[model samples]
Target: MNEQLQSITGVILAGGQSRRMGRNKATLTVQQQSLLEIMLNKLRSVFQHVVLSGSQAAAYHTGLPVIDDFFPGCGPLAGIHAALKLCAGRGVFVIGCDMPLVPPELIRYICNCSNFDLVVPRVGDYLEPLCAFYHRSCLPFIEQALNQGRYKITSFFPRVRARYLTAEEISRFAPPDRAFFNINTPADWDRFCALYPDLKA
Candidate 1:
């Protein structure tokens, strides 16, 4: 583990309902590795502690701790809220399980920017909140948001100190399109397979 990441706990936001994909995306495989496994490999290389945010621990079977949302059914905000609670004031490096393309070098760079409460990547108007680092200082705002039904992942961003990695900065590690490409539907899987045709079978 990188010493700079000792205070960070890696979190995989795997609680998505997957209705659009028509199956649990986490179970989908690439080159014989489950999406969850692929996501774990990306995070485990940078942080000592890694966890999944889901309904049941056994559902993932990854052996890492799975935290169920305290504000059940809310959304990714709820998962981040619950994971932040367990960080004990440490920051959380969160990524969605559907986002199998994010690289660890980007994760390490973001985690190194610990001066802000959030370290997110932005492409003009879009923010990659799911593939960002969230500080525990965001908990109260997140709590208020969830209570008020503000379930968007970026709902609490306004209230926290945030550093957005620009498209130019993010491009150094990987192409912006592939770095953030997430598999949400069968069509999305087809697109990913097109890029890495060897992984399709």
Candidate 2:
């Protein structure tokens, strides 16, 4: 673990309704580990303080602190807002529960570059906001967006200082597609299983 990452908190956003998968994606199993477990282990390796957003603290038995959405039904932005509040003064690395294969190396890179209010990855033209870094200072802007009923995570991007990792930079850690791959449906899970049979779903 990098010493610099000690001041950072890791947050796993597990509040999604999973309408597409028709099940709680966080509990979905890959190999013998649940998606939540996989992300928890990965984040615990680098961050000293790791928490779950949108899960009941007692639900997992892992002892990690769990925080529910402060603004429920507001999408991931609310989760991000809650995580920022939990982080307090420390920076936070936020990743969705369905993004099971997010590379630690990539996380390290993002944290290393998190000098601004936000540090996000750009794969081609799209931004992977879920697997990104946020500073506590972003709280105000995020709160404003939520209060205005703006749910898109990028709704407040223009109002903050943000750093974006280019495709060339991401390739050094993992393939672009695999790095940000998130399972939202049965077919997506099948695709992941086919790609990594040893870690079959």
Candidate 3:
């Protein structure tokens, strides 16, 4: 955590509707703390500043400032836009709401990656954009994509610089595939609990 705090502003994306979970995953508990609370706690240790990117006014009461997506209903891209727009620094480290096992060491490694507009890990040909870093330089491309109604998270990648983490590269920190796991459904949550026995506490 100390290593990651050197230079980064963590942005926790929690604006999703959580339809699959049938409840607000952000408020779900893991050891008594809400998922959002746990995420913010972990991020605060690594980032110089932390901001919650979402529209939930109730979250503002948590004492951290909240930033909403400039354009709503566009999925993760909206969260990315909000982070980019409200970040006090030039670069922002983004993390999703449901990824409780995100390793801080891995996050630090990605943040330290210099000279990249975006730094993302690839999980079997799929890019994990939700858990990555973005530079202010990507703002124009994001704006263009949003205006054009092309809100896919990776739509702006072709127009900007991006560093992808191969399976081998990520394996140093976690199992090539397990590293990107998260809870999206009750079944997944149950499996995660079984795998990470401590989560049930």
lDDT per residue for candidate 3 within 170-192, as digits (tens), equals 87887754667788888888887
TM-score of each candidate structure, all chains considered together:
0.95, 0.94, 0.91
Best by lDDT: 1
What's the TM for model 2? 0.94
Relative to the unseen true structure, what is the C-alpha lDDT of residue 132 in candidate 2, on a scale of 0 to 100? 93
What tens digits encode model 1's per-residue C-alpha lDDT throughout 36-147?
A: 8888888888888999896844577788888989999888899999999876547799899888878788899999997798999998899999999988888899999998
Q: Can you tell me which runs of candidate 3 are displaced by over 4 Å?
A: 1-7, 199-201
lDDT by residue (tens digit), candidate 2, 11-60? 88877789999987888887788888999988988788898887443476
Better of 2 and 3 by TM-score: 2
lDDT of 2 at 155: 93
